[model samples]
Each structure stands twice: as C-alpha cells, then as structure tokens.
Target: MGNIVKERKSRPVNLDIKTIRFPITAIASIMHRVAGVITFVSIAILLWLLSLSLSSPSGFETASAIVDSFFVKFVLWGILTALAYHIVGGIRHLMQDIGYFEELETGAKSAQVAFALTGVLSVLAGILVW
Candidate 1:
C-alpha cells in the first residue's frame, strides 16, 4: 500500500504541460541546455557554409547567395541568439560555482536577470544582422 501510494504520487504528468509555470532558475537551466544543443547543430551548418565558401569560385558564390537569402539569414540569426544566451547563462552558472547565488531567492532573481538580458541582446543582434 505504501509503495502504491508513492508510485501514484509520482505518476506521469498530464498532457497540460503548457499550463505549468516553472521558476526563473528552472527556466534558465532549461534554456541553457536547449541553447547548447542548438549551438551544436548550428556548428554543422556553419562548417558546411565555411567549406563551400573556401571551395571553387562557383561554390563561394553559391554560399554567398545562400547568406543573402532571408531564410538563411534568419537561421544564422537564430543560431547567434542561441549562442549568446548559452554564453551568458554559462557565466551565471560559473558565478554560482564560486558561491555568488547560492541562496535560492538570489539564484532565481539572477536567473530572471540573465533571461531578460539574453532577450535584449538577441534582439539587438537580429536588428544589426538582418
């Protein structure tokens, strides 16, 4: 009976995941992992672009033309945004390592600050690039 009750308490979450509101630190941690993955995948695309640009003249022109297209530009901008957020969040985690935001409330507030700063920088980068 005790095991059954514990298992019931730990049941799978309902499909209403969107309605859940996570804390600031939780949001920051989640975004940090997501951005890391995005950056990893983005590196592949970037390498391909770099190789094409370094190849024959036709290949270089093709790479340049792809950059000029709105879709490619948008994808590049997205990668940049992810990179920026991941870097900033990583720094925040480093500070925590040195005992800066060890407190629960302070850590949560710092996370919110990081999240807000990421949004501002991402927007500025998008505007500057596209």
Candidate 2:
C-alpha cells in the first residue's frame, strides 16, 4: 500500500484543460451535469416570473413586458435548451442503468444521439422563445 501511494504521488498531473481530450461519453456526462445546474438555477428565475405574473393584473402585464424583451427571450431559450439536454441525458443514464448501451460502441452512439436530440430541442426552443 505504501509503495502504491508513493507511485501515485510520483505520477504527473495534467492540469491544462485545453490539452485534454475527453471521450464522447465523458463529454455528454459533463454537459448533463452542467445542464442540471443551469436548470436548477433557472428555477429561481422562473418562480420569480410566475409570482410576478400572479400577483395582480398590472403585475401580469409587467411580467409579459419583461418576457417580451430580446434578452429575456434569449435567457428563456437558454433555460429551455438546458432543460431539454438534461432530460435527454437523464434518459440515456436510465437506459444505461437498465443494461442498455453498456458497450463502448453503443454508449458512444447513445451520446451522439443525445447531442443530436439536444440540438433539435434547442432549435425548437429558440423558435418558441422568439
């Protein structure tokens, strides 16, 4: 155990992120985590908007006006995109847990499919937001 610890300590660590090339599955997994965080943070913004819209008649109009802005629309699109990606990634993970796409080739293909689905969803979300 001591020798193993010494050996591990002697190994060089690559801290340069740009130089690292992650596999497709790893990239998909990382993006899924990022999307989850975005979705979680977006809940606050969405709740605030909902509260504003429900507060009173004037508040509804104010919320509508705020949502009509280009920047707010863009932010909404981003939130939707993240939500879509997170859902797709979650499905992929569930499939994996069920003993599907456990092989290297199949896993990569699933990751690719997830990326494509996310792209399509993002485009649809952009259209909806705009």
Candidate 3:
C-alpha cells in the first residue's frame, strides 16, 4: 500500500514593512545606510559650491550669496547631521567587528548610545550652521 503525502497551505503575505517592529540595531543599521547615501549625494553639492567659490571673484560672490541663504544653510546642516550619524554608526560597526559589543544586550545599548551621540552632534551641527 502507498502512503499519501499531505501538502500544507501557505499563509497570506504581508507586504507592509511598517507593520514590523524593528530592533534598535536594525534601525541604526538602516539609518547608517540612509546617512551614507545622503553623504554621497551631498558630495556633488559640495563640489559645486567649491567650484563656484574658487572659479572667479564673481563666482565667489555668487557662492557666498548662495551660502548665506537660509534654505541653503538648513540643507547644509542636514548634510552635516547625516555625516555625523554616519561617522558614529561607522565607529560602532568597527568596534563590533573588532569583538566589542558582540553580545545582544551590549549591542543594543551601543546602538542606543550611538543614536544619542548622533542627536547631540546633530544639534551642534545645526547650531554651527546657523
């Protein structure tokens, strides 16, 4: 006699990423990725600013005017904030790779500390920019 095999039914798919609760480490990792992308894009803006400032006297004046704008200052502040976060996150990653904060509890705590440091430095960056 041949035995029958049973097939299990698949569950419905949930496509919303927002419905999931991510851990602090996961959030920090995602933020680190986003900050890296922001920093990469900011490089083009920086280069343009540099070129405008260094090309000629008129160019320098134009660059100065652009830099003096409130919107430009805000954008620069955001870029700097992203840079600060990316740097802090990178340091934490490096330490982890070197065997520090390897445990789950310690890793989570480090993530929290990195975020706090980022917040403080972001405020400082905003202050300096304004």
Each candidate's number of clashing pairs is: 0, 0, 0
Which of the two candidates, 1 or 3, achieves a greater lDDT against the reference? 3
How do the residues 66-128 of candidate 2 rate in per-residue lDDT, one tens digit apiece?
999999999999999999999999999999999999999999999999999999999999999
Cα shift from native, residue 68, model 1 (Å):
1.0
lDDT accuracy of residue 60 in candidate 3: 99
- How accurate locally, in lDDT, is each candidate? 0.92, 0.97, 0.96
Model 1, C-alpha of 115: deviation from truth (Å): 1.4
How well is each residue in 79-113 modelled by candidate 1, as lDDT tens digits?
A: 99999999999999999999999788999988988
TM-score, cand. 2 = 0.87
List TM-scores for all candidates, in order.
0.83, 0.87, 0.88
Candidate 2 or 1, higher lDDT: 2
- Deviation of model 2 at 129, angstroms: 0.8
**Candidate order (lDDT):** 2, 3, 1
Could you report the Cα RMSD, in angstroms, for every candidate shown?
Answer: 4.0, 3.2, 2.9
lDDT of 1: 0.92
Cα RMSD of predicted structure 2: 3.2
